[model samples]
Target chain A: MNYLHLLDYAGVAVFAATGALAASRLRLDIVGFIFFAAITGVGGGTLRDLLLGKLPVFWIKQPLFIGICVIIAVLVFFTAHLVESRYRLLLWLDAIGMAAYCVMGAMIGLEYGISPYAAIVTGISTATFGGIFRDVISGEKSVLLSDEIYISAALLGATSFVFLFSMGVPQIVAVFVGVLLAFGLRAAALLFGWTTPRYKPRQGRKIK
Target chain B: MNYLHLLDYAGVAVFAATGALAASRLRLDIVGFIFFAAITGVGGGTLRDLLLGKLPVFWIKQPLFIGICVIIAVLVFFTAHLVESRYRLLLWLDAIGMAAYCVMGAMIGLEYGISPYAAIVTGISTATFGGIFRDVISGEKSVLLSDEIYISAALLGATSFVFLFSMGVPQIVAVFVGVLLAFGLRAAALLFGWTTPRYKPRQGRKIK
Candidate 1:
């Protein structure tokens, strides 16, 4: 639980930084930057909570998360030059965040007594869908679709969490294994330049 | 029920056309056009359904909406010039779509036996949120938060729907009254250049 809490906080920090960095590139006003940062930090969790029928929302209930995200956004705002290699950092940091979120989400679902299959599905979705949404809103091709290993790795990690839990393994061991697997898979994909095949229209599918 | 179905179809067509028109402005590919159109057509309703605990998604269950969106996308793709004055047409067409969707969403909530207040909230959300998302994703400032009466009109309409329903009015009459109020309000706003005041930073809350 301690490790999970730490990782979740880390994930929030990284996601907030990514949002501020992206919004900065667009030369958004401070309010817009804050809005984007806040969205990136809590959007996935909010969506997950909404889907799971959890009320008041995670950030709404724990305003500390929102405060943390704002602080991170402000920090990034002042240190833009210091974080010049934003894209490179965003990629690796997001990988770590995704890994952590996958485990956290799956654990939360399990805690709520949801079915194992649904828990895994929700966990992976909570880990990756926010990035997908952020990219979509930013008018970029969703890395979730383009970067095949991202979502797939989260799914794998979440499924492993469920599997290990079902096998009477300790939560600590299950989380450790799940996070490592997701991080490992994502890192390998990045290092090896792995990609999914791009979707191409078939002959009969083109619009007239 | 008959009027509701008609309104749903009308809203779908208007939303799809507006989405396709917006995509054309970006000089996007056919796939992007289709994607945008489909998202515009069903995005709000899907969100409403998800929030209300409806599953499988309405569009997934009804392929007719998808087919229509695709057709609209194709039409706008080839006849881009036909939508040259997009901003003007978009406003009124969007109003119609908004009115219809608000009523339908509210009715759905009522059917599901949710609180009237929640139903009204869902209705307004369903009516305006897709456009908000569509604008945000395309890098355009969301019209909902801008100097526009968009969301407010939806709220007014939704409120009217609830009021009339509670007054023992026929369902069709209630819907008609709600839609007319929304449509008139939006048209007035567009013609008169009415706008909500922009949020200003509080005095002494100095933000850079």
Candidate 2:
């Protein structure tokens, strides 16, 4: 439990940093950086809790989480120019955060007695929805719309956790495996420039 | 209660049509049209429900609501070419949908014993968030970023409803007034090209 809590906090800080980096890229003000950071830090968990009918929301219940995000945002705001290749940094940090979040989300779903299929979906959503929200708000194309294997990696991770759990694997072991799978896939995709195929329209077929 | 239900259904249909119109403008396929319509129709209410910790979201429970949205999307898909000035039609329909949704969201918030201030925020969010989601997904800039009075109108309408409710006004009458205020404000804005002032940075002022 303690380890999970640490992972959760670390995931949030990393996500917040990614959002702050995005805000810096757009040259937004400090307020914009904080707002984006806070949203990206908790957006996925908030959505998962909402879908699960959890009350008060996690961040609302624990102001410490938001405080952490704000602090990270402020730090990123002041130090953005000190970093080179901000985009690469954002991608790696986001990948690690998504990996941790996917496991946490899947566990929460199972704890709530949601069906396994639904739980996997919840996990994937938790891992990816925050980035989607951030991208949309910042006028960047959503990860979902890209050919990158981001969501697929989350889905694979989530499914592995659920499958391993159902097969009598220890909860911690299952989570470890899931996180490794997600992080490994994402890292490989980033390093190797792997991508999913884009949908191509058929010739002479009117889309409308 | 029945009247409220009717208004909800009508609002969903109207919102769905607007989404379908957006898809048509983007030259998306049938699946895209349906996807956009469904999201726009239920996005605001779903967010409200999730935030309020309401289970089994409205559309999931009813299914009829989603069915109606799908039907509307199909209709818009087929009839898009027959309509002149689809953009104008979409704007008008979206305004009407926002008005109805604002009142419905306020009523739901009051039923849940939320504070009046929060309830008003809920109303405005419920009226406008769907459009924001739609715009984001369609790769269009959200109306919130525009100098338009859209969100302000929702805020005004929601505040009116909550205030009137607190003053012991009848629910139906308060709702009527709220909807009228929102609709009228939006209509006037559309007609007269009313706009709020945009924020301009001072010369030589660093944003950081």
Question: What DockQ values do the models have?
Answer: 0.06, 0.12
Question: What DockQ number belongs to candidate 2?
Answer: 0.12
The superposed Cα distance between candidate 1 and the true structure at residue A6, in angstroms, equals 22
> How well does candidate 1 reproduce the true complex, by DockQ?
0.06
What docking grade does candidate 1 earn? incorrect
CAPRI quality level assigned to candidate 2 from its DockQ score: incorrect
User: What are the per-residue Cα lDDT tens digits for candidate 2 across B72-103?
Assistant: 98898777776667777888999999999988
Q: Each candidate: what lDDT? A: 0.76, 0.83
Lowest-sum lDDT 10-residue window in model 2 chain A: A198-207
lDDT of 1 by residue, A1-208 (tens): 5777787788777777777766565555454455557667766776788868875356544556766777887776666645536666667777887888888888888888899999998888778866765675656666676554788789879999889988999999999999989888988888897665767867785665
Best by DockQ: 2
TM-score of predicted chain A against the true chain A, for each candidate = 0.90, 0.94
Window of ten residues with lowest summed lDDT in model 1 chain B:
B199-208
**Interface root mean square deviation of every model, in Å?**
9.4, 6.6
